[model samples]
Structures are given as structure tokens and as C-alpha cells.
Target: MTSPLSHLATHEVTNQPPAPGDRDLWAGDIVLRQAIARHGGQPGALEPYARALGTAAMQEAARDANRHPPELHLFDRAGRRLDEVRFHPAWHGFMQLSAEAGYAALPWEEAPGGHVTHAAMVYLASQVEPGHCCPLTMSYAATPALRTTPALAPWLEKLQVRAWDPAIAPMTGKRAITLGMAMTEKQGGSDLRANATTATRDGDAYRLRGHKWFCSAPMSDGFLTLAQAPEGLTCFLVPRWLDHGRNPILIQRLKDKLGNRSNASAEIEYDNTLAYRVGDEGAGVRTILSMVHHTRLDTALAPAGLMRAALSEAHHWASHRSAFQKQLIDQPLMRAVLADLALDWEAALKLGLKVARNFDGTADEHRTFARIAVALAKYHNNKRAPLVIYEAMEALGGMGYVEDTPLPMLYREAPLNGIWEGSGNVICLDILRTLAKEPLAGEMLNAELQSVTGTDRRFDAALKAHRTRWPGLPPEAEARWFAESLALLLQGALLIRHSSDAVADAFVATRLARGSGRIAGAISGCDTGAILARIAPVE
Candidate 1:
């Protein structure tokens, strides 16, 4: 007779294998190779880690496109997901792989490359799959939902499998489940108070009644839904599938968008459907903030991968293309432009890493430093990537603009970085709000600035000018100042963190040794000594 575990083994073994298109294995491998090259060809350092992450990414990519393929009604005219898709099994698998690779604990790493790798992975994931990996949002939404509905607690733990370990136990190869958090009704986007959804407690469950303009992933298993509870505005875990396992949620229509064509957006109506409460009454806004921070970081880093890909494409084009009877790269002006693009790309990558570092450093801080850093990163890349791509496009003449070149697809994807996970204005405001609550946030920011610029008069003057422009004194004025200062601090940190002190110094010394006036001028302009002095005091 077979042992009792034999049946279990049989069942587990019989589970369907991941389908042919279920994994974007090639994309993950390509990204890993690119990341290693960008970081000085240290493939051995991250190869093991990359292999693990690539496996997960491939699995998720396949799930994202195939699992419950976004129906015709789930998207807007722009192709954005109007309803949140339920988190797919692949989503959870990737998150689990990341956690296993020690990405979640990366703040503790002293070396910058580890942080860069994590940041790069984030960028890659967001580009490959957006909106689904809103862990920050889910963490915020799930905690409260779990407390009220004890039955949903197990699912909450299950959700973490996607982010922490998708290849083990019950979650092995399982995908993520998504929770929708956006509001598009008449009340407005920023003000949750204007929401009209109502929840009436009915014994063990509640009845949800409302019309949500944009519900991302409506096909998802459940949502951390915002509805007006008796006490105040509250959130609930409303399942798309009802008690008997039938979907009560209705998808009114899908949106067709310019970018992120693969993602589905839908307008949805939530009838008097059964729902479970999350957290206490009137805490929907507070809970949602957690999710926002997570997504903001994601939104911030998403463009970097695209930028890297575009830069690589441009570099290849420059080396091969010839103009004016000379290789494009041989032209001084073109070379200068390419060099600038490289600098910008490097700067963007570093900025993203710095943000990840901060995220790793202060896991418990109430302030959303990661969110601010992510916003700045996104804003800068959004601004710089297009310029780089266009320059590359010009280098290729007509080919770059056409689909024949990767630049066209990249160009189309670039703008969406600025729009999603909260717009630029929204991100700036978020930083301001976070800094205002933590007054020391400004001083800490100053400390980082001091580290980079030292105590030089020029650097001091810049700091003073910034303070004067936006002082952290009056409540309103202080908030603005804190935001601006934080932005500066983040920028300075990125510059220092990503810059190889040895390389910069060697480059400068060689130029000075050769009597290169331009190099000398750049050195003089930088006020390195002053910056060092200021930074020394902080250390």
C-alpha cells in the first residue's frame, strides 16, 4: 500500500506545468546580462542571484500576459487597466524570488552594487509588468483587512508568498493577488473624503454599493476596497468572486491607452456585493498611504531599465553608423552627446540605487523618504530618457523613429513613467507632506548634502539659496522648503553614491597632468575641497 504522503506527492506532481509562454525567460536573462555589464562586468558577483531572479521574472512575465487575459471591458481607450487585475501567481513568484535574493534586506549592504542590482531589478519588473506588484499598497491595505475578517488572514499570508517566496509550500509557483486602490469618481483623485461608495454591515459580511470609475485588476481575487462605513471612510477586502464562487463585480468597459498596451484598464460597478472590512472604520486613507509609497518607488525605478535598454541601443547604433565620411562615434559633437547620455544614464541609475538604500536603511520611519527619492528618480529619467533617445534617433536618422528601431517603442513607453504611480505634482506633494511631519527630515537631508559638497562657500551658497528660497520655518513654507531640500539631498547623495571617487579623481588628475584647461576648469568649478569639508563635519 502507498503511504499517505504518496497521494499528496501525486497531486503536487500532477499540477499543471507552467505553459510555454508562461515565462519571459529571455527578457530576464537579457536584463541580467545588461545589469552585469553596466556594473563593470562583475557577472560572477550577481550571476547566482540573477539566475534566481531571472527565473522568477520569467515566470511572472508569462503569467502577467496570459493569466486571466484582460478582457475587452477591463481597459480604457488608452489601454490602461481600469480595474485592478487579481495578482497573478507569477507576480507572487517574482516577489518570492526577490526576497530570497535578499533584495528586501538590501538596505544593510555597504557596497553600492547590491543596491544597484535591486534597483535595476525593480526597474526591469515595472517595465515588464506594471501595477500588479503594488506590495506597498497591498501591505497598507492588507493589514487592516486581515484584522476585521479573520478568515481572510490566511490569504494575506498567501499574498506575501508572491513577494517573499513563490516557490515554496502552498505558494510554490503561485502568483500574486492584487488589490485596487485608485479613485476616479466625481469626488476627485486626491480627496478620499469625496468617495461615495457605501458599506452596510450585514452580520458576518457587509453589502458594498458603489460605482468605481477605475478599478484596476477587477478580475483579481479580492480588492482592498474603499467604502463609507458607518464610523467613517473605511476599506474592505471585497472578493470579485462571491460566496458560491461566482463573480458579482461588473466590468462596464475597458480603456485603450497609448502606452502600456498590454495592461488592461476597466470601468467597474460594485453592486450591493458581500464584502469584508479592513482595519478600523475611517482608516482607509491611512491604510492606502502604505500602498502608495511602495508603488511610488516602483514607478520611480521603472524607467531606469527602459533607459538602460535605450542607451545600449543608441551606443550600438553610434558605434556602427557612419556620417560625414566618418563613423558617427568619431565625430566630436556626436561623441560629446553620447558621453552626456552616458553620464545621465549613470546618474539616473545611481539615484535609483540611493533611493533603494534609503528604503533599506530606515524600514520603520514614518516618513516616505523612499517615495520622494523614487519620485525624483522618475522625474529626472522621464526628462532625460526622451532626450537621449531622440539624440540616438537623430543619429540613426529616419530608422529610429520607425518601429524597425527599438527607440520608437522606448520613446512611446518613456512618457508613461511620469504619469503613473502618482504624477510629478502628486509625488512632490507627498515629499512635502512627509518632511513637514518629520522636521528632522530637513536637517538629515542637510547632513547628506554636507557629505557631498563639503563646507565650501559655493556649496554653502547653494544650500543657503535653497533655504532662502524655501525655508523650513512657517508651516506651509517649511513644507515646501523641506521638499526642495530633500530633492537636493537625494540628488547629491546619488551623485556621491554612484560616482567612483577613484575614477573621478584619476580623470581629473590625468587632465591636469596633460595641461587640459577644460579639466582644470571643471575641477575648479566643483569646489571639491569645500564639499569635502562640509561632509567631514557630518561624518
Candidate 2:
């Protein structure tokens, strides 16, 4: 069968505008049109290239936003490429479909579906492909304390090989070749202060010795690895193949993961391998953190996409499936559920777009909003999606639990959203920390709340009541309390489109009138409706 994305191959060539009826295609098409216009209509110009790359990258990311493979295997058991297998093309087609649909794509053909793919693609394009040199180059850039690091002048020139290569393609729908970021050791995941890998300064080259766990994209061409230099933590570029020498790294094991099975996550060892320092020593953590900030956003987006897909399935199921001699759509309960899902999905989608905009260079206010928005979207979507999946399944009776239904896969994959990037606890803590540092964040939040309350006196009254009832507290305590409260605030901000104060206020009022109890539940994390109500409310 011809895949839905078969049209994309000829989309540019034909010069036919996208149909206005399909919102996904229209969104992408409009963006592309604006980008082309901004670039003076020359598709090959640098600005145009960047814009096209960004647009295509987003589309690619959305293609596999939700769904997981049957197994975790970017490569076969024998450590051979899995893309060579027959199923690769089908999976690729599926990815394109998701992208065209404005859903998320998977890293590997069989990985769990979600918005992470979009974030990953964007991160790869912005940070890895355009920001730094290859993984090897990034490692070399982090040598011996990062102070004496040489300018990347020579390496940066050589990194242009990626532009022509185009790791991701809209027409062919091929996956990009990855350069693994393998930094973690068994002793530590985030606490790089405890990494034990060593890089001894050999005569002409550094000899690396270490074991790395969670080496993502292990089968890629090279790795950006972190090692303990005599000076401090340093990074190195270790290639899979050398022009004149044999491969130096050895694969120890591939992790059997709960999600993202198509992307290789391996345990690896390097023994006396020759390496070049990236930047100065002790800069490894800082450099990697920069890279990871982008990666975390990507990770957060993946689950956002998954939740969207799950909600979509729920919407479809509710509208079509029948029970108790009536269509599920006829039930007030189901309508409420579906409505909440729609609201949540729209909020997440808008939040994801806003984050992308900030990454593309928006104001500091937008940047702050994007951070809070992304975190809240990830938190709420991760929690809400499974319930939608469950309700969808329940509505479908036995069919929902069956493998034949997408609901089962969505249910299994939903939990990973919360775990990947960072757990809910970690993200919430980060949000709290951000609130602590920026008194302005709270003020901005309060402004937002007031704006929302202004639209409906009732909602304003409710918010005032809640605020008054909530005692005055220190910044730290306020941060904790505000985590959930801020989520609600952002939810209102998003629903109002953040485009106008009045719309946001109206959304808050409507939500308050219909779901005060549910809102309270969300803050406490007890009832699923707390999350659901944010998305689909009674009103």
C-alpha cells in the first residue's frame, strides 16, 4: 500500500500548495512558506536551509510520537545494523505518516512512539549537527579543565560534511546516522562528579580506559565520551572506525529497555584507545550539560507526542465505540473524558510549539514561559495519557487490552514518558528551583493568574479564595506549593492561547466552574481527573 507520506516526496517538486483542510499539513506548509519567504525564496540559501532544516526536522520528530517496538534492538543481537532488515522500510513509512500527521517520530523503527522524536531531531540538527562538530569533535572540545581549549576553527570547518548528507530526509524518510553520547558510568548517571573513566596522556595521543553505561545510539559512527583526566573531567572523541587504524571501542552489552527499543542503548568499554581531547579538562560536565539541556527538551517532547497520540486514539474510540445499547459518544461521561483529552492535547501541542520558538530565539520571557510550559506539558501529558488509554480500552471492552488495538501499546509506552528525560520528581524539583531563583517567575505567574481570573469573576473569585486559603510561606515552600499551582496557572495560560489575556482568563473561569474538584485533585496528584480535567473539562 502507498503510505500516506508518499506525497511528501513530490511536495516540493510539484510546487503545489498544501490543502487547507488538513490542519497538520497546513501548519507545516504555512511554516515552510514563511521560512521560504524569509529566505528570499532561495531554498538553498543558508537562512532557507536552516529554516527548511528546522521545519523538516520538526515534521520528522512528530512522525513517531507514540508507539514502541516489540523489542529493544537498534542493531541485531549480533551487533549488525537492523536497518538492513526488511521491516525497516515499513517502519520508516510509519514514521513519515506520523510526521505528516504532526505526530512524533521514533529513533529506530521499532521504538516507542512520541514527541521525543521531534525533540531529538531538532536537538541533533541544532546542537549536534550545527552546534558542535561530530560526537568525536564534542569530546575533543572538552579536554583538561576546558580553560586551555583550542578554537574549534579546524574541526568546525570539517564538520560541514553533515549539510550535504542530511541525516534526516523528508522524501526518502530515512533515519539520521547518530554519533553516540556515551558518558555515564555504572557508578553514576547524572552525578558526573563521580565518573571513574581515565584518560592518560600518552606520547602523542591520550589512552582512554573506562566502562560506560547507557551509551545511546551505540552503533553510530563515533562517540562523545567523558573521562577522568589528571586535571579533571574531560571529553574525548572516539570513533567507531579510523581511516588508518582499527576500531578502538568494544561493545559490552545493550540495555533491554522499557521503551525506545529501536535506538541502541549499550554498555561499552574502551581499553587503551587512542583519543584526542575535546575542550580543556574539567569542562566535560559543563559541555555535556549544554548538550543535555537540548536533549532533555527533546526527551520531554517525546512523551508529549505520545500523550497526543493516545488522546487521538481515545477521541476516535469514544466517537465510534458503543456500549449499553448507546454510542460511547452519547454518554455524558465519555464526552467529558474526550473533551478533557482534546483540551490537554491542544495545550501540549501549543506548549511544544512555543518551546521550539524559544529555542529558535524568542525573548527571555518567552524562554521562561517555554521552560515552564514544556515541563508542565511533559508532567501532565505523561500522567494523563495512560488514563486516556485505559478509558479508551475500557470503552472498547476486551478489544482495548488486545494487541490488535493501539491502546495496549500506548498504555505500555506511556510510563516511559515520565521516566525518560527526567522523572516527575526531578522535573518538579527543577521547576521549584527555577521558581526559587526568579522571584520574577512567581510574579509573572501571579500576573498570569490575575489575567485569567479577570475574564470570569467566578474563576477570579475561586483563584482568590484558593490563594487566600493557602498560607503565606517561604520561597522554598512556595516553590513546592507552586509546582502544582503553577501547572494550573500555565494550563490556564496555554488554554487562553497565551496570545491574549482575556482568552486565558475565560479558560480559567470555564475550567473552574466545571472542574474545581478535579483541579484540586490534580494539585494533590490523587485523582486522574486532576490531569484529565486540565485537558478535557466538564464545560
Best by lDDT: 1
Across 279-325, the per-residue lDDT of candidate 2 in tens digits comes to 76777776665554545555444444455545544544555556687
The digit string of per-residue lDDT tens for model 1 on 1-539 reads 33334256346532221222222322333433443455533344345544453343463453354343444535568986443343445555554555554443342234545444555556545434433334433432344335455667666655543244222122212454334553556566656678898889999778888877766544545666688989988867776554344445767776565654444556777777787776778887776655555555555566665665565555556566666787765666655455544444555555665565565453543134554456666666666666656665666667677764456656666777677656656666766665667666555566666775652343455556666766654355354444444444455444444454432332223222221233112232232332222111100
Report the Cα lDDT for candidate 1: 0.53
Residue 51 lDDT in candidate 2: 39
Count of backbone clashes, every candidate in sequence? 61, 46
Off by over 4 Å in 1: 1-70, 73-118, 126-151, 162-176, 180-182, 362-368, 371-375, 378-389, 455-460, 473-489, 501-539
Error of 1 at 517 (Å): 20
RMSD of each: 12.7, 10.8
Measured with C-alpha atoms, the lDDT of residue 378 in candidate 2 is: 61
Candidate 1 C-alpha RMSD relative to the actual structure: 12.7
